[model samples]
Target: MKKNVVIGFLGTQMDAGKRRKWRPSVQLCEHPDFPVERFELLHDARWRSLAGKIKAAIQSVSPGTEVLLNEINIDNPWDFEQVYGALFDFAQNYGFDDEREQYHVHLTTGTHVAQICWFLLAESRHVPAKLVQTGPPRNNTPDIGTLQVIDLDLSKYNALQQRFERVSGEYNTLLKGGIETRNPVFNALIERMEVVVSNSDAPLLLVGPTGTGKSDLAARLYELKLQRRRIKGRLVHVNCSTLQGERAMSTLFGHRRGAMAGAQSERGGLLKEADGGVLFLDEIDELGLDEQAMILHAVESGKYFPLGSDYEVTSRFHLIAGASRDLAGLVAQGKFRADLYARLNLWTFRLPALRERPEDIAPNLEYEFEKVGKMLGNQVAFNADALPAYLRFATDPSTPWPGNFRDLGASVQRMCTLSPRGRVTLPMVQDEIATLQRIWKDAHADADAVLLAEVLGEGAAQIDLFDQAQLASAIRICRESKSLSAAGRRLFAVSRLEKKSRNDADRLRKYLEKFGLDWAQLVQ
Candidate 1:
């Protein structure tokens, strides 16, 4: 015959009473009819001794009953979301398949809130088990338990799906119908992101390079929240890179009259403007270390004092921080507060760069043309040849979109502007490619020019772009090599094998000589 498996928490009250007594997990097993084949008792980290004693007691009462002690770590047992989430996650992954054996949860143990969570999970079928409420023997009658098997399948509830659809529609508007996104991971991320923004008031950190729609997404989130009546006010956006010192502080926390020079009147800043709404802090990595703590306090407590104020003020608003730089590196370098980083990192999401999402290029290009049509009040279309040619170049590995979507948007803008008669032809595509090449080259020119000029000095000015590009490649190879021979072998991988015996170093020396450079200079 198959036996029953019982899962329960070791109640603190049961563990009390100044003697070795009956814990619920043990009590259920000690019952004559219960006949528990196994007991799984969850215990908080600090009460391991109590759990051990309970486990021993259960084994002593029923020698054949297998007891498994599970340790749960929690900062505060009363935190409903944390506890519920932990238990739900555990149940979600636990094996619920035992062909002959039955599962039961002893609900007579644990805190009231934990009991509620257990019941909810069991009721929702998240935890597949019958809830067992155990009681002690009274007046010589044997102790017994009541089993409740609740059937609450969320799928059976149409209201849940309706609500989900409504929430999804809000986000669809936010994403402009998600025109360019087809990747399964990105689609799943959107669903997860909607759930996050729905309930969380904690700061959200968008980790992606510039032009990845960080600010736009933040604004759209605010709009979604407002549509749901979750937020009552408008979004307040600020680029922290544009802020500095006192001006930054004043802009974020407001300022009293006479707080500083030219402080003619009291001013409500971005934080105040975002009261009951959302504040999108772009380039937040640029914020000074001095301001990091102040922001942290406001985030944690929803309280802050305006500049030159005698009393504290409160502004409770959701925060959305965007950063292109490595905020973690800055934190390690003592440029940002660890506390602030921890808080903002709770819901961090990285928006992939345009180069990383090639599947999106065609749709986004079409979107750009549609945008152009609306802006110019004229229909615009890319010719068959022009469209494919632009897409080929856009998705090529040789292109590094440093500015990401901003570069893509600019490319579309330029092509559309240059496209006469609202039709993008082959000539327009060619011109846009040339413009992009020049733009990308100019962006990277400073670094390359510095390296080349330092190595070649006056000769760098005389060297054409082709030779300079070759020298840069040679220098990169030399830096990566442990010896001149390795660099030479890599540089002339195909040609070096043609030699009867490889004289890589000699060949490398001659190659460097032609550029008026040497091995030492290349490596350095």
Candidate 2:
């Protein structure tokens, strides 16, 4: 019978607490159900004595159990994202090629958060593992206790956790332009695209506001399809919004010699060049009706007539179209071709705006700083206060991020450009915040204040400026929330613990009543 290979970290705190008690790792190796071939114990570099004890315990428990120590470092166990990122990278880069031995992740050891990371990695197939959880006996009887195998997909603790892991893993790669995975709608869209790219060559439509990473995603999808051998040629991209009748026609479908004033040489358009590859049209909704009709035929039949050429050209290519405006509305207004819309509407994925995914702000900020480091040939650092200051305003519901990531990117670009000695100071962050506030409020005509005035009547103008801003933000969050409890939880994240009993809804109600507002009026 082949023995199993168990992999996990050392439980320094747990084992040290009771040295005479039966340790979980020792019992795991001794357990009759789990016969170990080799035990790989990941431990801290400083824990030599602990490692020696663990090795001794394993040897004594099963005598023949082979044990090895793998030293590693965790600079900060409390930083969830950093720890999770390091472990995930380790798991991704680890080699697990022995087919003769089955692998299990011993979850009884390590920090609680570390255990969660292990489960998530395994659930996503990144670690290719099942969980082994060892529990102590019910009584203080001198016996090794019970053990349970956790299959994430089937376990009561996390039946759908596997699905979330699968999605997050892909986002860590595919939609990694920034921390865009925090948006559920955006995450699900990319997940769908993963399947769509592999199975279909039909045109895909990315509908979202400008600067939502549509263009980047289109190129990425093309690259993925190329790797899958779904497309055999290079990507050809065109911005339809920048072209017109003659230029658009000549640019997309190619032109015969002297096809137009500028066609002094023979030219095969982007579509022909994209033969056997992907042709991405950015802001495709801006295509003229004639251009739209022409592209529709090419999309459907894989054939088109180049400018000033009667002979037809065939280009078998996958089409990816991106649009910022509402294409369906344009179709209704007769500005866009309905037939063309129908052709690309098969797989439409909406990329949510940045303000809509506030959770992504910090990761993206760090990512931007990393980019700055790469470009400047030295790392750039943010003052400890800089990040929080920036995020506080970026996440404000009243802030309208007109350019989405474009706006955020420009902000970072400005800050990085202005950083002194590679450090972004609090003053720099505050200046940028004030600039953003002025721009947003000036450009959008204080929509929030207008709404507040309409909602609160004379009370809005009478309220202090700070109170008005707070009221607007709270109301916006409340309106977006599913329930009063949900809204209250968000509003009182720090204060909720002080409550003797959890009645967030009642607290929210009383707060609203202070402003002579009710859930009904605000939510509506």
Candidate 3:
């Protein structure tokens, strides 16, 4: 059985009287429910006489209880720093054996400041003890007081536990740039990231289409780590596609003086600069084979050789790689290194494209509006009629946000810049909508022309615009499917229902023959 130990201040007035009638110390020792095996009395140096009296009284009440008086100097009992420091020093040196003893900190016999300090210590785990507050007897007789134990572990309390969870959720929302994203998949992704970011420094890979906020998420995650003191260095962002040849190698791994033709001085690489912080490599799939191999080595062993250097350098950093394309596909095609992919694939998060999250558009628009307003020093708001009109078009099924968040952000920037006197009127929204439609139409037309040209050479120019649209849809489905019949079933699902014989493959072949194209040619 564990011994019950009670530690408290010597209550100068409450435990001072020679008669044990109203003395709290005597009440604690004589309590029938709680039999304290040991008592540790803390008192000011001037209260030695009172401390001695309390110890004697406690012993008289319970002869089996061992009483020890500890002397502590407190210049001002009300001074938080002085009292807390004194108590903290005592607790630190006291050598508590929690395995064989249960500690109860008595809060009834101290100043309000002391009581609060003790509670803080126990709550923060500076002292492994439970807080126990004692009250005088309800009857006017000389009886034992009431003892209530308070466990400092907040998780045991439902309300406090819920509050912590709510705060954690709010923090994650902030990490996503305060957009209040309503997508379930996106919210769950953020929640998982919260745990991974706090616990591990392993490389994170973000896979998504371009403008899907990969870079933004990486930057925000770095900021979160910095705020939490998990990292001390700054964030080094690298757009891999923008780098080329020797510059790419030299940029990532520092170069010694005169390493290249234009090398005027030694340059410390981004990896070294990001030591103790985050290194976000956007479009990582664009990196060369050699760079990928070097990254793999660095990630595996926190060590890599800089350009034109014989000796290797060390850089311990959290790596976050972003890719708009399928890295696994690139790996299979031998364009990306499989080893590097495996290393970064440990924690992969796929950010959803804007079209996949229509519900988040309105909230994102508001967030973007606020951001632009702060940047331009002018708050902008959409008129009542314009807000719904813009949202209707933005959330429509046919409205393809090919560029994802980048498209939305650019649209907002253009409208806010053109809004008269910070008011986005209905006419302004109509003009923006028209501009977006024209842009999308032109983009689709260009894509169709390119697709047809790739398949039919110059014969693509002879195809009518009406046939081009239908042909492009067929070609896309065929390319995505494993076989011609599979693609046909999807394309002719409604039409095949009208026919008794569902020869989807033959129908698809005939459709291709009308354009003088074969299944083999279109699939290619």
Could you say which candidate leads in TM-score?
A: 3
lDDT of each: 0.81, 0.82, 0.89
Rank candidates by lDDT, best first. Answer: 3, 2, 1
- Candidate 2 deviant stretches above 4 angstroms: 1-172, 178-180, 441-524
Which candidate number has the best lDDT? 3
Model 1 per-residue lDDT tens digits across residues 1-524: 76688888888776553443444566667766668888888888888988898888889989989999888776777889988988997797778776787888887877888888998888877887877876655566544333343334556669987997876766764754457476555566667778888777678898888898888788878877787688897888999999998999999898999999999999988898888988888999999877778888888888998999988788888888999988888786578888899998899888888788788778888887787778877777888888889999998877788888788878887777776688889988888889889988877776766878888888888888877778878887888889999888888899877779798989889988988888887776
Model 3 whole-model lDDT (C-alpha atoms): 0.89
For all candidates, the clash counts are 0, 1, 0
RMSD of each candidate relative to the true structure = 11.8, 21.6, 10.6
Per-residue lDDT of candidate 2, residues 387-425 (tens digit)? 777788888887788888878878888888887588888
Model 3 lDDT per residue over 1-524, tens place: 89999999988878885444678776788877788999999998999988888888888889989999899989898999998998999899999999999999999888989998998899887889998888877866446767788888887999999997987887697678877889999999999998898888889999999999998899899988887788999899999999889999999998999889889899999999998889999999999999999988988898999898999999989899999899998897689998899899999999998988989999999999999988888999999999999999999988998888888898999998997599999999999999888887877567878888988889999999989989988998899888989989989989899999999999999999998988888666
